[model samples]
Target: MSANKAVGIATVVMVLCAWAYIALSREPRLPTSIANGRYSNGCCGTIFLHDGVMTVANQRVDYIIERDKAGPYVLPTAYVGASVHAVVVKFDAYPLKLRLDDAAHPHQLELLDDAADGVRYSFTRVNGS
Candidate 1:
């Protein structure tokens, strides 16, 4: 083949490879199976997510996601917790961060921070919740 034709083919191949890599490597949405349900924390408080709305202590908190820092990342793998798998979700109200308990429980949020320093909540999945 001509040198020009060969170079053109090579360039196209490189571009295609780079595009594929970028598309596949982008961060993924939080898994619904792990994000959906009711998690109880404290003596009588609960954090519930149904159809995308999160309810905490009977107050409905919507997903924030785009006030500049896009989030609500329920990544099955840790996004911000570092050691323990956690999600940096942006909510309309409190508890903007969440971490999982362990690999043993897939459908659970181990802990949450209320954005107020020293105020944290730990939770476990309520049966059938």
Candidate 2:
């Protein structure tokens, strides 16, 4: 192949490789809550697991206050115990409880903000009936 053609093919291959890597490695971006749901800020976010189903929530209001005094934001956490009843996982799938909280530790706001890719809410489940 000519020098120009070889260079062109190499460029195309590189682009294709990049695209494939992004498509395969990218995590799914899901909403933190349902519309009009009663959620306090910084409480709701996505739950990733090694097994079981993936889920998201808009409950649990642990917001991160930035050091620069910008604003607070929600972070996602796994729904366990009674809190699971409040959350509504997307696609009408019930969020099966994977475990229970052993201690009364405050939610980790900073981790949620840094890890969450979208807006956060207060709890995973909606309020009221």
TM-score of each: 0.49, 0.30
Prediction 2 global C-alpha lDDT? 0.32
Per-residue lDDT, model 1, residue 53, is 65
What is the Å distance of residue 46 in model 1 from its true position? 0.9
For model 1, give the 10-residue run with minimal summed lDDT.
76-85
Global lDDT of each candidate: 0.50, 0.32
Question: For this target, which candidate reaches the highest lDDT against the unseen true structure?
Answer: 1
Runs with alpha carbons beyond 4 Å of true place in candidate 2: 28-129
**Highest TM-score scorer:** 1
Off by over 4 Å in 1: 1-5, 16-26, 30-34, 64-97, 100-105, 115-121
Model 1 local distance difference test score: 0.50
lDDT of 2 at 123: 35
